[model samples]
Target: MSSLPADISLDTLTPEAVAKTIDHALLRPDMTVDEVVEGCRLCARYKTASVCVRPCDVRVAAGELKGTGVAVGTVIGFPHGSSPASVKVCEALAAIDDGAEELDMVLNIGRLKSGRTGEVRSEISQVVRAAKERLPGCCVKVILECSLLTDDEKVAACRAAEDAGADYVKTSTGFSSGGATLADLRLMRASTDPATTRVKASGGIRTLDYLVECLQAGADRIGASATAAIVDDLRARKASAPSA
Candidate 1:
């Protein structure tokens, strides 16, 4: 939704070779409306691809960014995907109503680990249905907390998210013990079918180097609180390079 051009075929935005890899995240649980408004404003000012925030402020963000192209996104199950199916649906519906253009739901890690892949898949599908029904045309990203899963489980989750109709398979909730790793990103990137799915790298990504790495590893988007710093770093690097 960011006006910065999601497609990089022409490559005119940033020259880091991966400007699209950075998504400006504002998922503070206690972020106030005024703060969200300001936070989203900052994301737009910096030309971030998207702004991911808590559900409570999705509508406010959407309203604030009508023409900015900066997408409005929110977390569904959030750090824990253990909520019941009904609960996740309600949250997704509410977030859409509040103007979220995208939903990032946490997968039921426990259920998946407990051999409840069916239930996990169902939960994600239902949430996706709810989002699409409400938004009509929108995207849904499922957070798998990849650090906790075995490679096989990660692959299974990626496939499940794809089958469940999620637009992207995300790395973490930023509340986990670890965050996106290059290895995990690569594994997931290759695991998901690129034709119908994407990889979102979030959680502990706070540098330009990491951002570039995420993009090269097949990340379609990034979730970071350090958006300004990264962009500034890109600008600085460009400014210091000798003119050809």
Candidate 2:
């Protein structure tokens, strides 16, 4: 993890601040509609940054979160990035039409590993273009699936995503062998220009301590299923703090 400045203190963090960093995940393949609705309610209660659901659940999530101050997001070419760019673009457009404000798209991992950086960048660009054209200010996050890549490939993937004009470069899909790591988060933060692209640490971030560490390591956002637990814990801690 990247070292924080000596003056920095996570102990002063607020629950609202922590809640805003989370993209409450509702992407489990077996999740029922009722569960998705409940998850959307959870997001609204906590005021999370977004609720990231499956493609088919975009409209459901959107309807539930409408006017709740929480955005609706969905994945494209999800766990696998083998789909053609055209397909990903179409999926992104449909997601936008369904009221999704954020699109987390998996870049073609195989192509990146195969040394086809141009192809990878091109595909990401296409999705970004299609999404932005459909909905201005729609955020796009490119998932790197870091556990499957070497440090070099991860760096290349970050650069490719940034070059393609993605808003964030995320760590994984949670279906992979591993999730976000402190080292990976630090490396990703270092690889991207902070002004244009931010880092999102996803996969296996189920606790507040680990989430704070990811933030210190330069993650601007978090993707997790434990949003309520994490935020509630932070709120409890703040409430219990001794009076100055």
Residues 1-244, model 2: lDDT tens digits: 2123433345757788888889999999999999999999999999999999999999999899989999999999999889999999999999999999999999999999999999999999999999999999999999999999999999999999999999999999999899999999999999999889999999999999999888888888999999999998888887888988
Q: Over the stretch 111-162, how does candidate 1's per-residue lDDT look in tens digits?
A: 8888788888999999999889888878899999988899989988998999
Clashing pairs in 1: 1-69, 2-69, 3-69, 59-98
- Position 224, candidate 2: lDDT: 98
lDDT (0-100) at residue 130 of candidate 1? 83
Q: lDDT of all predictions, in order shown? A: 0.83, 0.93
Count clashes in each candidate, considering only residues at least 3 apart in sequence or on different chains.
4, 0
Model 2 TM-score, 2 decimals: 0.96
Per-candidate TM-score against the hidden true structure:
0.91, 0.96
